[model samples]
Target: MARKAYSRRARVTGTLMLLVALGAAGCTGDPAAEDSPDAKPAGGEATTARAEPGKYQTLPQPCRAVETGTLDAMLPGLAQLDQEQRQKAYEGTSSVTYDSDRRTGCRWKVDSADAGHLLRIDFERVVSYSASVSDDARAQAVYGDRMKEAELPLPSDPREEQPERRADDSAKADRDEARATAPADDEAGQGASPETSEKPGKGKEKEAGKSEEPADETVDPSAPAEGLEPRLLRELADDAFIDDQLTTSSSGSGQRTVTVVFRTSNVIVTVEYEVQPKQVAEVPDSASMQEKARELAGLLAERLSDV
Candidate 1:
């Protein structure tokens, strides 16, 4: 009887212990598993992010990229040439480049009965050597350097006066200001005569003269026309600018060079159009040259995207 009683007691104790263990587990809740999202990934190191590469890896053929019709239009003298001569003129001589993929250029010079024309086009494909830097970033830096070298005018301020004359004007203005502010040489009011003393009307007249001084009347011979001043271009490409330079020879014949530069993706295109009149009395037109150069630049930018 005693053995039977002891066995029943042991069974009761085992059941009570099991129930307590289950209750504790329910209150505490289960620990997060290793595969949980909150846990670290298999590798301790995080993945490194990389920049996207440039859109263009190679450049188009510089000499053949432009259409023959474009050539004829830019070089109007082509119309006067014979069929064989025109065809030969259309095929421009390619500039020598060690690596054509990196940089390439083409230029043509033609003389007509009235004037001379020179056209040049250059294409550059920029590549980034650093893994952290992108090609587009490098190209932007390069384009900025070119812009600085070109000495483009500020956006808000227009260069109405010539560059070489600015210093002279500034000096003159400074001198006038100094004279106006300078005190009269230690005049003794006690002994001052009426003739030497500055009269009220005389001082007023002097001030009026300073205020009425005429502005610079001499126009810069090399300055572009009012609306044709060098400025930033818009809607032509990602970013572009046009500059017109007019230089006259001793004989008074002017040579005008219109340059347009733009960048698309990682490629940069430049167009240089020059016109030099043969006659001393003749001068190149600024508006027409700028238009032609800008048009060529826009066309080249579009073709580069397609390529």
Candidate 2:
């Protein structure tokens, strides 16, 4: 009997210990269970956020970017210019870029009996250090700033209409008086109801009112002045504008400069072309210079996109 009781006691103790072990296991939770969202990942690895890389990793050699034929076409006076000056101009001067990948430029200038012409091409590959901001977006912001600085006029929307205001009080009063006298005249007319008489008379009066009202000389409030004209461009990069500046030198010769700025992806290209006619008081054609600059810009944009 004593041996059996001892055995029973041992069995009871084992049951209690087993229950305590299960309770401890339940309290601690499962070690091999699926991970909760709040917990760290399995391997303790973290993702490092980074901004997108610029489109062009390297820039074309600025001096060689524009071809010889293009230079000749852009500067008509190149052959007629002094030999020493023409040689110097043909070998364009390159900009000193610390990070050639980020920015570069080339410049050429020559003077002749026909005209003095200057051409400058600049390339800037935008880069953003912030992980949340992309290089292209940074470039877009810079472009917006350039547009604002140039004071480029936005294209007018045809849907937008402004109500004309009456500048003459006497004219408005006259129209009001005519409208008031119409009903009495219709009432006085035999067999002429107010509706019939007023309809035809009111039509005539409205026509007269329209004719008498002074035409408003509306002007685009956002347009830049005549001297500093900035116009939008198409068929180039994403967004672009051209600025035309005409300045007269002390010698009385006039110089017309056209600056074409365009953005493609993360790159911004600026082309500055100017023509100073040889004859005093003569001015370069803004349209002609703009076309030449745009042609050069398109070429640069094409090369940058290929890279």
Per-residue lDDT of 45-72 in model 1, one digit per residue for the tens?
Answer: 6566666788998898888888887888
Off by over 4 Å in 1: 1-46, 157-215
For candidate 1, the per-residue lDDT at 113 reads: 93
Would you list the C-alpha lDDT of every candidate in the order shown? 0.84, 0.80
Error of 2 at 147 (Å): 1.1
Looking at model 2, the pairs that clash are none
| Clash totals, every prediction | 0, 0
Clashing pairs in 1: none
lDDT of 2 by residue, 8-53 (tens): 9999999999999999878896555546555567598656667787
Q: Give all candidate RMSDs, comma-separated.
A: 9.5, 8.6
Worst 10 residues of 2 by lDDT: 220-229
